[model samples]
Target chain A: MLSPLLSSSIKYYLCFMQTVIIGSGNVAYHLAKAFVLNRIPLAQIFGRNENELSKISGELNIPYSTETLQKADLYIICVSDHSVEDVSGTITTKDCLVAHTSGSLPKEILKGDYRKASFYPLQTFSKSKALDYSKIPFFIEAENEEDRKILFEIASKISDNVMESTHEKRKYIHLTAVFACNFVNHLFARAKEISDLQVIPFDYFLPLIDETVQKIHEIDPKSAQTGPAVRNDTRVLQLHEQLLQGESLEIYKTMNLSIKKMYQLP
Target chain B: MLSPLLSSSIKYYLCFMQTVIIGSGNVAYHLAKAFVLNRIPLAQIFGRNENELSKISGELNIPYSTETLQKADLYIICVSDHSVEDVSGTITTKDCLVAHTSGSLPKEILKGDYRKASFYPLQTFSKSKALDYSKIPFFIEAENEEDRKILFEIASKISDNVMESTHEKRKYIHLTAVFACNFVNHLFARAKEISDLQVIPFDYFLPLIDETVQKIHEIDPKSAQTGPAVRNDTRVLQLHEQLLQGESLEIYKTMNLSIKKMYQLP
Candidate 1:
């Protein structure tokens, strides 16, 4: 009841602390822009290359640097896989809270005397496309209770869906994502390749692709499964194998057999 | 110049002959509705089961059959794969055209004296969901030029994207579809199962799922690939493996290794 002075002091403290982004890649750029849109001051963005940093700096109208890391409330490392260790090594902060924007990397890698955490945004990012950050899920992991709360608060400010996922769980989720997204796209690319070889337009597969994705919202995949492999239509499958004679044929047969085995088709 | 009497005779022939579908599954129901909506009176839906047949018959107000196959210019067998041979066997007419709605099955499997063909719609179907068949790609294969022309005419009546794909090409396309659609859905299901076990809400993953599909429309998937294995963060990957230790662990390792190999990640 008598904490009027403390409340005003806390409000002033919050208004002054700035958030800094320490990378210029897709995740970092998107996160920084979201922060800026939320009216949070983006203190500085750092990159190894001035040219890359200039692109993001020009787009967001934020300050850029190719210099050494400085003390900030939060330092987010969003470099590539091979660059993570080296990037973290170069940062000089021993007291500031540091985090990496990675799904699979442990927060411990970024651990120094400072607090370590992860702010992994679980979405694919492209520079040309403006992402809907509110729909993206941010996986937060932090060292202590206060840091965890801070990370969650920061993530919640930008995204509606924020969860505390461990490094292990996020990794497993990432692996499943590769199977669900990346590999599926590869299959579509293969379909496009073969279709193009026969002078068939790639747009022909778009409707099928859209319908297939939409089907899962209604039924479980196992029950919704179709095709010759599931039906054990050997004659048709053999003809397909004959037509795709070579590496493409091998890929086709392997996938067919996998589906057949999964469905217990003869 | 064509003769006036010959043109009048052709008009007379077209007025009497029509396409009739023989099954009440997803494909037949949707195709019949599309035909009726397009002002084409060519759908004569037949089903062996009374309940399924009556359901579609009641909705479309089309003629339904449970015991007999009525004479039609074209009969499209849209039954289950196991029942295709039996249905074709039952409808043995020397001169009537017969086709099966299957992507994998060869046209010759109808094996009747009738000019057999395939009118495979390359898309997933659900009974409860209303599909816009005009957007669906129809792949037609026929025994002769006249049959091809007839099938093509029927396909073009509802859809703009129609192709004359051989049984072999259709089979390969069907196989590729399994990898692209069915397998991807399975991965999502598995992710749901894991999230359920962890007491995480299933809706949390929906945003990730939606974004993954959306990213493909922007760029090639190989370049858009993300996650732990691609990032080569071994520590996080090992932690994730440890978390998923059970039947799911095998799936986790296999998918992770596959992604790593695909990306040539160290």
Candidate 2:
């Protein structure tokens, strides 16, 4: 038994782990491309969208189909949060490792008697954009030790940043991402709206936006905080409040209040 | 008359523009350093803080004094927004071009007969951090065309991004920056707060944060947005909401609502 397990593990590591990617979205496309680029042989790409699946299939030179799914060493379900469970149920390969690439969902959400796991890459993905996979952080979770090691080793091939994170921790991770990435982008959109009102070209604010992100890399965000809210400059804050209306005003007020509260400023 | 003016302008450009920087703060230190780096001569560094003034003087090989401010072709009031008018009153040089480095305040606020102008560099500055000045946007405003040209030329020496903006436009620019830089940093702070609660290392989120900012450079932030709020995934949103409290909860809900409103998602 030990000889057979060791032999298979060695073979998996030596050449490439046979993998099948489910769903044809941003995450699916990017992950498939990364695997191929790293010389990891994908057995097939399975998804409901024929057009998207074909694009991934052609781009990565892998077989893809909408109908039948193939058995592989691992199956990565890269569907939406709502569809992760349903997609995970379609994989019929018993005892095979099945992982869902979700930041919020737990490994238990993947139905089946198979070894369940999560191989979450912590970055926003767009189908058209290429990314440096090596820099992206991949959070891995598995029910058992051996599967965890397997997932870790595979993730390590594409990323320098990989770690074992539990579902509880990952929920917070996803929450933080919403605040840092999603909410941050919303603020950018709001800034663009305000700039549009004044006919100030949105490009003018890009440098400041870039610098804001750049600053936090070297310093903590709390320490990196600036502007009227942090400074408690009532005059400037009031002036800004007057210029905005409706949802913009509400956002401006709420954000300012939050900032002030964070720093314990009056 | 044109020859004299042209000769003086040529001389000003050839050697260096004699400039005095008032108020030794982040803006003062950065602007002063940028001027010296671009070979623009600093006549004096004047401010109330002897330690900061001396540091700038010693580092830049320029004179420093809290006692008397010197006369120069241009006197830049790099004081805080509240102190700009007061600092402008101290510069005794009549008819010399006077400028304040302020984003929100108008050029007319420089309370003197001297040619009033605003030389606002749209970036968040830290005393210890070195920045690429060429990437920073300098918004120039002046009472006269010649002064505007002078400010533009001076700004162009250190930065490639320079624009002539009115007081009206600068106010909105400043307001938009509050959303883009200041508010964005606050969100990062809040994200860090949530991540800390779960003992998830903040560094893990840095890649996601960096990618979020990088994505916006290529696509609009509206298009770049992702997460539960954008997707309107009620399950994940509710789960995240349950974990946060107080200002964090308030921020999460408000930001999500704003995003939903922006995208017109239910």
Candidate 3:
């Protein structure tokens, strides 16, 4: 039966928001889980890795497609930043609103015969770690109004935190995240290594680490910053430098200088 | 009327454990505040700066001692790293416990006619921030069994998270904390600046920061690492390097190499 809205666009409109998530990494895993947890089921998952795709699909009870991009209302390519272009090029559907979940890449990368958009979740995703979707900021950018509205609706259903972040700003956030998340984690890794070398259990650091994060909850990062570098405590700083070696020493000195410069310490 | 314990030896014994916290810095402020809040009043506060000491003393209604370390059971010198020895030297009691709240300093620094100890709280403190004393890990070290027992009892009363850590191990933890707390906070400061320069608000990095800390709540830092450096994505690494400069660029390269070396990536 043909409805009043039935036209050449009827098929595309019917497929509009039904999603097919591509890739099976951290983002894809969590996003797929979020869809199911929110009762917004994914239509299929397209990925080249059979082992991972099969495991993910089997767990979610969604069909897995490895051959090509399946027909759906939306195709979310969750590949690495470098592969976003290549992966998006393969999904050539004029009707579907195609999006890649990358903070660094511009939405234009997904522009093709199909609709273009970005569905970046501005949070770290680890496979084993559980996270509340409602707290995760979902940054959506679409090629057009219709696609934007659809993406917004989908994102809103999945997470309470929805923002229409532009490509340019998201890129900046991505860079900052490298410092806040990635680089900070590197620091923690180094801390563990240092503690291990000194024959102290890593558990001694948990409270300090927790307090460091908890400090920023009430104060700005600048005001919350404290250490020998901030205090310009040359005695303690030199003693620490003497204890470290190689890359650890380099990072210690580099970060020390960075903190000194930040605080305008001599 | 005089009791049997009121003799000359008894006089000094009664003074033991009654604390006079020295200095009014962040550590001293929080420790004094904690003691007050916990209904355990500090006997006095000795500060070279009368203005700061008066303010804190008036707030807590504790006596402010500027002339010298007032006779007390415990004199906790919560001064700077370089001043621990000097501060400890001022207290020339024969039997009272004299401790410094310095993580880097050895208990020997407080060695004198008085009993030596360390009452280091292993957490970052800021005047503007409020923290639950129970969560702060107090690392206590003492010269004798009686002093150790007293310090443990006091620390336990203030914080459930108390440990009898040695000077050597505590020093190692302090070094690790420079990487975990101080250095990471420095990274957050840098992230905020980079984000500001790019015209992005610092709030965008908060969620990322929270998640970075949250990730470690469940897993080890090494297992939780996710970024270009861990993935060894040289393309994105170079792109990010291009956007950074000076100390930021140096930190980027230093941290990148550190991560690579840690992961043993080519």
Candidate 4:
């Protein structure tokens, strides 16, 4: 522990780091908004899409540019994974820390001689949706402890949950998100497709979908599990499989088999 | 369209129909609680599980019995699908409407001289969890219009969403539930398994899980889909596939293939 005066000065130094965001997409928009809401001033938002960038700048009241990059203590590259290297290379600011906001890519992928870091917010972002920023978990990684502390302090201003994670752990985090978020949504689409066959309103399934998610918060999903696959109900399983065809049939059979195998049901 | 005097009497008749619930499981517990909360009088709660029944009775102040079931105008069998027929047979009340609260089973499965029906509440229930009964969709099917109206009125008291669904449609509804609820929960469990290996706290993933579900309420899940599968990022896909083993790996591959095929991606 340090003296009270020294700790306050150190906190001021951590919070005063000038930051610039590079992108006009969902993640960039949400991040900029969160920072603005939290009173963390941004130097500029730089992106190629002029129309989208202008919209964000207008809504967030943050300065935007399409060509010239702003000089800042930290630059968060929020562009696509493929574009991260190219966008990072365009930054000519020397001795400044640069971080990319991506789940799958490592910090080393940033093509810059300056400090490299990752400022990953592990949640899905949509431009139109209002998020509770405090609940979102931010995973920070940096080449050195000084930059890591900077990123973590900035993140801590907007979110309650923040941690420093390695590139290896972040890879699995992204993979786990694929299974939990993306695959789960696809299943919802498939379920809607089936319900639509009989003109059953897809809205009817929303409560069950909601409760399924709510259950796991309290109960371990394995113990909370229910339905045909877990029960090994052959009669109902045969009926459901016959109702599906082509890719739907494939998914139904595979998921049922997986669930049965997981539960050790023969 | 009817006169107010006759219509009020008809409404009175519908509301006055006495309801008896059978069984001592999640469905039974939730339905009983919902009915009591809505001020809908239950004649008695009948079930063989005396311990669970006493707990429900003690909390709800509703009469419970392991052997004798009170005579009522309507009997809603809320037992397991396998025990539904046998429990419905146990009801010796003459000329009363009998219904089983099941998604998959047909109303005709009830073996009795009395009228048969289905009063299925489409939701996942747990004894420990509190639910917004108004959001749960009630699918009612009866052999006659009078019984249907009675159930529709009773269900309407507890839920805002009540619909007359056919037994055929109910099967599809049940099957849709398996895909949307059970299989989706299984994916959440798998996600936890992966995250647990990296020693990542599962709480961090809850916000993502919530947003995935929240996105669909506004956007169709197909258009809302994200991740390596939808992005067609073969590198990330390969890495994720390599991280998983046995059933998890099989599920990962099958789900990715299904998502790719649905998107018409190579």
Local distance difference test values of all predictions, in order: 0.72, 0.87, 0.83, 0.88
DockQ class, candidate 1: acceptable
Task: Report the lDDT tens digits of candidate 2 across residue range B1-266.
Answer: 23578647855664665788999999999999998899887899999999999998899888999998887888989988888888888777896899998888888888877889899999999887788899999999987777887888789889999998998888899999999999999999999988888888888888888888888788888888888888989999999889999999998898889989998989
Poorly placed runs, candidate 1 (over 4 Å) = A1-14, A81-86, A144-146, A234-266, B1-16, B93-95, B143-146, B228-266
Q: Decide which is better by DockQ, 2 or 3.
A: 2
Ranking by TM-score: 2, 4, 3, 1
Share of the reference A-B contacts seen in candidate 3: 0.85
Top DockQ: which candidate number? 2
TM-score of predicted model 1?
A: 0.85
**Local accuracy of candidate 4 as per-residue lDDT tens digits, A1-266:** 34577556657885676789999999899999999999999989999999999999999999999988988889998887778889999988888999998898889988877999999999988787788999999999998767777787789999999998989999989989988998899999989989888898898999999999998899998888888788788888888877889877888888888889888999
Residue pairs in clash, model 1: none
lDDT of 4 at B42: 85
State in Å the error of residue B181, model 1: 2.2
Per-residue lDDT of candidate 1, residues A1-266 (tens digit): 22567545544544676667877777778888888777777788988778878988888888888885656877888887557777777767677788898766788876367788988887777676678889888989988766776677677778898888898777766655555555565555556556667666656666776776677666665676766666677776776676675445655566556567666666
TM-score of each: 0.85, 0.95, 0.92, 0.94
**Displacement of the residue B225 alpha carbon in candidate 1, Å:** 3.2
Question: How accurate locally is residue A208 in candidate 2, as Cα lDDT from 0 to 100?
Answer: 85
- Model 4, position A90, has a per-residue lDDT of 91
Model 4 misplacement above 4 A: A1-10, A14-16, B1-18
User: Who is ahead in lDDT, 3 or 4?
Assistant: 4
Tens digits of per-residue lDDT for model 3, B1-266: 23444433444553444778999899999999998897775889898888889988888888897886677777888999988887777777787888888888888977478778888898888888787888888888886666776677678778887888898888888998889999898888888889889777777667778888888877899999998899898877887887889888999999999999988999
